[model samples]
Target: MKRIISQCSKELSQFKRDRLTLALAFLLPLITLFIFGFAIRLEAKNIPLVIQDYDRSPISQRYVAKLFATNQFIFVPWSVNDSVEIALDRAIAKAGIIIPPEFSRRIAAGNIADVQVLVDGTDSNNARVIKNSIKATTNDFMQSEGLIPETNLLTTRSRLWFNPARQESLYIVPGVYAVVLWIFPSLLSAIAMVREKERQTILQVYASSMTSTELILGKGLAYLIVSLGIALVVMGIGAIVFRLSFAGDPTPLLVAIPIYLWASVMFGTMLGTRTTNQNAAVQGVALVGFLTALLLSGFIYPLSNIPFPLSLLPNVIPARYFIEITRDAYVRGTGWIGVWFAELMIFAIGMFFFNVARRVLSKMQLTE
Candidate 1:
């Protein structure tokens, strides 16, 4: 017990002394959190809209006025020669609203009126939002003017389940858990173990009375505690700055986080065991762990959209499972039953990496 405590204390002291690791563990994550939290916006607002009203009627003018009155769209100047396609192609407008000469005539005769909407489909999400906003606005105008009878229309009062306001920050901020979990612990463990090899101190540890399991645990525990502290700080930032809510029971998060941290630490220990150089360890952590988490963990992009063979790659990535668990816990407010499979998978992966690292260290000790 005393030896394990000493080993833990030694690792903590060494971590404090190494300025680079300290910065990587603490500072880099906070900077990234701020950047992603404040800068990345998913909601489309104030879209440039081009209006072509051939109908010189009061009704057409009223419709145009209603559309421009909302914050969702800004009317851009349009000329008679400028076609909807031309306006969209030239990037002068995201969407073009064309009112025909018969728009008021058809409405006055109690007949259906058609309005042409030309939208740039380059960005699908933005296009969808624009279309929905236009549909809602038009419906509201029609209802108010008695153009569309309330009895004839079926209204859907859409209650957004998890995020009521449909704020993008709510969707994004919770993902910080997966990002921080991937970067900090892995980098810290990799650098710490590789530093030992670089300084030829690993030999001294192997020769000491401390068993390999004790050595691994002592180092792993120190980083695990630090990583949890970082996670708490990040959660606070998410709650305070981004207004992220934790509506669910925290039991799943509490259960999953330590296991996920262990998996990351074990994976890092494996990387450090395989590589003898600190530069190579750092690079490996960046390429294998950090980049993989960022790209394939379903953090920024949906896994379904990724093409086959490549899509299967995320199954092996620990961050992928952890991100799902986080979203389930933080966003959907799902309980242990919802996340139990992912927790089991994380534990399995952690044990696999821990065994591999143990074997590699044992082999290295024998060679020495």
Candidate 2:
């Protein structure tokens, strides 16, 4: 115990002695939090929609106003001489609408009329959002103005539960915690362990009285403390800037954070041992730790949406589970019952990392 503590102290001293590493440990997570918190939006808005109104009637004008009423879209003014096709070709707007001269006449006659809609499908998601927004807006306009067929219809009312305001930060910031925590701690520790190899100090440590377990524990413990500090600062800043507040029991996150962090640092330690140089270790962390946490961990894309064979990968991702804990803590507040399995999975993954590192280190103890 004393030896492990001493080793931890030694690692911490070395970690702080280097100014760059110290700055990276603290500053990087803050930068990532702000960037992701402000930049990523699940719900797209401010879409530029070009309108070519040939009718110029009051009803057609009202319909255009209704589209912009939700503030999801902004109208792009095109000159009378310019065609909607030209505006779309120039990439001036995401979508274009052609309101024909017969638009109001058809509605007045209670006849079906088709208004041409051309959407730029360069980004399928954005195009889909614009299409849906326009459809919903048009439906609302017809219903409010009593232009409907007046047939009985099935109506379902939707209440935006948990996040009524549809603030993207509420959903985005919690997942950002998972990605930032998973990346930096693992990154810092990977570089540190690889640096020991580059200096040939690991060989001396292996030959010393301190067993492989102590060294691993000490290094893990040191980086774990650094990981905690990173967590506190990153999460604190997320709360202040995003206006995030816990919606339910904070206990699930309190329990899951350390376990998740253990998985992160241990993952770094594993990468350090596998790679011969700091460069390889850094690449390994970025490719495995950063990519998996950012993409496969249900941060931006839903795990179910990830194509088959690839979808199975999220099962083992520690960040995937930690995201559940964090989002639950802030949004759902389902408590321990909601996230107990995620906590267990994170711990299991951490132990798996520790075991793998231990086996690797034990073999290396012979200095092979």
Per-prediction CA RMSD (Å) = 2.5, 1.3
1-368, model 1: which lDDT tens digit per residue? Answer: 77778888999998888887778887888888888877777678889999999997998999998998888899899896778889899898999999998999999998889999989999998999999999989988998798766685666777778867677776676676787777788888988888889899988988877777778888888888878877877777667887766768878878888899889998898899899898999899999888888889888889998899899998888888887787877678877878888889889999998998888888888787
Scored by TM-score, the top model is 2
lDDT of each: 0.84, 0.90
Q: In terms of lDDT, which candidate is strongest? A: 2
Candidate 1 residue pairs in clash (backbone atoms < 3 Å): none
| 1-368 per-residue lDDT for model 2 (tens digits) | 99999989999999989999988999988999989998889787998889889889999999998988999988898876688888878999889999988988988898887899999998999889889988988889989999875675876789988888877887899999999999999999889888988998988888789888899999999999999999999999889988999998998898888888889999999988888998899899989888999999999998989999999999999999999999999888889988999999999999999988888888888855
Candidate 2: clashing pairs of residues? none
Q: What is the TM-score of each candidate against the true structure?
A: 0.89, 0.97
- Model 1, clash count? 0
Q: What is model 1's C-alpha RMSD?
A: 2.5
Supply candidate 2's per-residue lDDT for 221. Answer: 96
